[model samples]
Target: MSAIDDLADQLARDALDAAARLGDDRLIDDISKAIGASSPVSQEAFVSAVRIRQALARGRAVMDSRLTQAASQKAGPEKSGG
Candidate 1:
């Protein structure tokens, strides 16, 4: 596969993994309701909103991982800065 296609595939897999982790029926219902409510808006706006939400979610996940790693390092004994 081309580089872009491979990246897309990886992203799809990651999204599936994240969705599986959520595994909350109520959360899914809420998301569905939000999307349904957006249907009255122009198609462009709906697509933009979805993309923005996804980007924000990805950013949150990255920030969460960095915070967790920093906390773990701080909790452990100091290591040589080698």
Candidate 2:
């Protein structure tokens, strides 16, 4: 992975660890309340991120299929003594 990906992965792991260590009912309640009170901009950003992820997944699937098809075509001629 790239350096940025490694850093982001580390940060996410650390954040999850910190959250797990809270182990407080009140803190969990407060976090739930805060999450339910997200602003419109944050909501929009979350939706946009979801959409982008979906688009990327679809693009990757298409690229993978195309690559597989190209490889099969290239191998077909070779196998046929072309």
lDDT of each: 0.57, 0.53
Clashing pairs in 1: none
lDDT of 1 at 32: 38
Candidate RMSDs in order: 12.0, 9.7
- TM-scores, one per candidate: 0.46, 0.48
Q: Give the Cα-based TM-score of candidate 2 against the true structure.
A: 0.48
- lDDT tens digits, residues 1-82, model 1? 5554454445444444465688743543354356457553333343444455568879999999999999999999987899
Model 2 C-alpha RMSD vs. true structure (Å) is 9.7
Note the residue pairs that clash in candidate 2.
none
